[model samples]
Target chain A: MKVSDGGTVLAADVFSSRCPSRSVLDHVTSKWAVLVLAALAVEPLRFSALRRRIDGVSEKMLAQTLRTLEADGFVDRVVTPTTPPQVTYSLTDLGRGLTGHLTGLLGFIQTRLPEIEAARST
Target chain B: MKVSDGGTVLAADVFSSRCPSRSVLDHVTSKWAVLVLAALAVEPLRFSALRRRIDGVSEKMLAQTLRTLEADGFVDRVVTPTTPPQVTYSLTDLGRGLTGHLTGLLGFIQTRLPEIEAARST
Candidate 1:
């Protein structure tokens, strides 16, 4: 994609358009992403704590989601220099802002669960 | 999955747990789902109108999203029986509610676009 302004030509950067932004979208809205955001919204938690908090999530998936979120700067992963190198995860400022949005989305889903279930029955 | 409620043994329905609700989640937070809900929030639009309003979406994907939203009762699809069938799509009360959620999510994404972009560039 290219945009021309006056006499100067500006390349919109197709790599930027189709690569990072799209990838970020996919990560933020992934299945685990929603739940993880919600989980971290309340407070930072340890790896195992997060794994247990979210019901029915596999450890592998959780780790993967956390890594992606970390890469995207939505999650802050801290490693404590402990006996076993205890790692904790928390939301960054931006991540917390994103969590507010996640809360709204999840709240809607939880509140409307009954109605949605009813609709599906028919 | 099995649950015990006092003296009553409840045989938890696995199919129900894994099917409709999950299916609904897949549709509601789907890439197009958020946008479709947001689009309908403004006003009812015809099929082609919606197709055009959303950028970079394929016809097949739009049609699929509309059908899923319709089936889930978030969207009301009206077909006028004329020489040429005129189909319009609008949000149901439930859909509007869902849109409120989507708005928050998308609003966050849009507002954080700059920060997110910067993060990805690194």
Candidate 2:
């Protein structure tokens, strides 16, 4: 099966290791990536703000996740050429499109936390 | 803000490092977990068939993922005590609910693969 993109792309199968979607999914579902996307869904934040929003994330890791998301078209990074050179990050249209699933999954897990914790202990 | 669940649950904030959802999200988004959930989203599969469907997953990792998912209540395990003792895995109702988001995310990525790849290359 083919997925037309300039008539050059094929339909992606997540189960197939050869599919590019597999790798893309990897980036989207990474621990830091998930958290970063969730953080941005509420509002645009500067680099430091994003770092603070997610617990246990290191400076280097947050930077790496942002760079990857920027490249993947899910994040928009803006640089202001000010005296301090301020930088901010927000979700791109593509990122916004993908964020619905993230939010949905998050809500599902959140509301069911009690059940999940109970399941774990048993 | 409060989210009542049995009058014992609290509202969850994913950005809060202390949220239980953080750890649950980690488990749900783990590379192997993502793949396993996607694979099982189709239908129940026996252990060997599931391993074959997901490329690059070893027996050990698959076992671990299944155990975790089972513990989390997103997956149900069925044992058929045949001569060979067959064990099958299927998504529980909870798993089914979460899978809609998974499939949604996967489709978004799959359909937009071209755009994503183009973004990455630039």
Q: What residue runs in model 1 are displaced by over 4 Å at the alpha carbon?
A: A1-23, B1-23
lDDT of 2 by residue, B29-57 (tens): 98889888988999899999999999988
TM-score to native of every candidate shown: 0.80, 0.91
* Model 2 regions lying over 4 Å from their true place: A1-9, B1-10
Share of reference contacts found in each model: 0.26, 0.79
Error of 2 at A55 (Å): 1.4
Could you give the DockQ of candidate 1?
A: 0.30
Q: What is the lDDT of residue A4 in candidate 2?
A: 57
lDDT (C-alpha) at residue B68 in model 2? 87
> Where does the lowest 10-residue lDDT sum fall in candidate 1 chain A?
A11-20
Candidate 2 per-residue lDDT over residues A8-48, each given as its tens digit:
86677877777778888999998799889988999999999
Docking class of 1: acceptable
lDDT of 1 by residue, A1-122 (tens): 23456887554321133433445666887877877888899889998998877766789999999988987789999999989898999999999988887777666665566687677668
